[model samples]
Target: MIITDTHTHLYSNEFDEDRNEMIQRAIDAGVSRFFIPAIDSAYTHSMYDLEKAYPNTIFLMMGLHPTHVKDNYLEELQHVETELSKRKFYAIGEIGIDLYWDKTHLPEQQDSFRKQIQLAKQYKLPIVIHCREAFDEIFEILEEEKSPDLFGIFHCFTGNYEQALQAISYNMKLGIGGVVTFKNGKIDQFLNQIDLKHIVLETDSPYLAPIPLRGKRNESSYILNVVDKLSEIYNLSNEEIASITTENSKVVFGI
Candidate 1:
């Protein structure tokens, strides 16, 4: 029952009122490991604070999110590089192309994505990609950067069977989260076709909450709902889903 939430923003201001209590709720529900993804330098201090508070359970990733690629992107990437040089991080990510919000920064996003991928290889760390309406763009960069060292999880994967296979070819494990529980969330249709080893569980908390909790704020504790849905999808018990996904996460994060 040691569930691992491979992606969650427990440091978000959304939890400012009861951060500790909310985390404890998730802990009580068996989500003991929380992998925190960085949006930019602004949240870096808060991420450190979170790690200090829960040293054992909190793991962090450093990167510049695609949407954050603005005029000051180089400076932000410098911050990412500086942080990586200073300490240990499980991965370099929550990074990749995000064309959903606006395509204005597409070129910059591509540059940032390429640079970050190189950084990941340099550090020998896995990458947790955040792709939205940009699979072809993400895959293009990944194709060019393909190597033995280019490996990680595809956070909040929402692609088709063919795309899943493509991502797997690049040595990525699909990060399944609350989206899998949605009625129209198509990944579940062919998820069983993909082996369990290629899957990892996540919540992307305060973002994509699963069914029954949809339209509401998500937390790590709500990951149990995702586990229950996965249990039905794979015809495995909840414990099996938790154990297997957590193990898969360790395979990527090496934690």
Candidate 2:
């Protein structure tokens, strides 16, 4: 079975020590596709190098992450636009409102988010959102930018069924990750009610590790934990879960 980790930061310094081994481990575990999200202009070279090294495995997205939005965000957005204009990107993402860390930059975050969404529309690419503690703000912007062409994944979605439906209304696929495997994750309870088509698998690795390995650093290979949990929750076989979610990922990333 082939599993797709639609969102992962393989280029992060977190993987610097054994990046090759970790990637091999993921391959051994049947995760063949890795979609890398951009943090800002700073990580672009690393991300591109990774794609070059693993040409068949890695796909790249371009965007300035919400947390990265700062006083000089306009310059960062210019960098994002320049890169996008220079080459092709799988998507425009990991961009959205994030108020959890600091609310001081909320307005800049909102502006960056809207600008990136416009960039995605201009390029005809889907967006991969990174929302935290700002659902109302994010949804408000999405509502304003709502159009036939504006659609993407709600990355690391851990909201309620109502939120799930609302995200779907915006034409986004819910990106299920390590949180689904947590005992108190809550999403597992209503996941079965959501169609498999509306869901895609991800690990958000070196971050939200799944149970049996929760509280530890996560890797792409650990995506198996998420697949196993999803199988149980959806009452389907692991292979089925992998295949369906992989296909759903393809539909979103156009891979």
Candidate 3:
């Protein structure tokens, strides 16, 4: 069975020591495809290096993360445009409003999110959103940018059923990650109500590790844990979860 990790920062410094080993572990665990999202210009080199090292397994996206939006955001968006002009990327993402860390940059974050959505439309590419404590704000921009061209995944989705339906209306698939494995992760309560076609698996590795490994650094190999939990929640087999979610990921990433 082939599992697709639709949103992983495999190129992040968190895996600097044994990145190859970590990737191999995921491969052994049936995770054969990884979609890497860009945070900013700073991570471009490492992301490129990762793609070079695993040409067959890793795909990359370019954009400024919502948390990275700052006073110099215009320059950063320019950098994103420059990078997009140079080569192809799977999507324009890991971008959206993140109010959990700091709300001071709300205006800039909203602007950046809208601009990146425009970029995604320009390139006919999908997006991977990183929303936290700002669903209302994110939805506002998505509402304005809503179109057949503006479509992607709501990465690490942890919202209520209403929000899930709203995101789906905007042509987004909910990205399910390690959180679902948590005993108290609320998404589990209603995830079964959402069809498998609208769901995709992810680890959000080096962060948000699932139960048993909760609070520990996560890796793509641990995606199996998420898949197992999903099986229990949906009352489906692991293979079925893997198959359906992988297909759902392909629809988003166009892989």
List where candidate 3 sits over 4 angstroms from the true fold. Answer: none
Candidate 1: residue 251 lDDT (0-100): 94
Model 2: lDDT equals: 0.94
Predicted structure with the largest lDDT when compared to the true one: 1
TM-score of 1: 0.99
lDDT of 3 at 17: 95
Each prediction's TM-score against the native? 0.99, 0.99, 0.99
RMSD of each: 0.6, 0.6, 0.7
lDDT of each: 0.95, 0.94, 0.93
Local accuracy of candidate 2 as per-residue lDDT tens digits, 1-255: 999999999987889999999999999999999999999889999999999999999999999999999999999999999999899899998899998889999999999999999999999999999999989998999999999999899999988999999999999999999999898999999999999999999999889999999998899999999999988988999999999999998888888
In lDDT terms, how accurate is model 1?
Answer: 0.95
Per-residue lDDT for 1-255 in model 3, tens only?
Answer: 999999899987889899999999999999999999999999999999999999999999999999999999999999999999999899998899999999999999988998999999999999999999999999998989998888899999999999999999999999999999887889999998998899999999989999899988899999999999999988999999999999998888888
Candidate 1 regions with alpha-carbon error over 4 angstroms: none
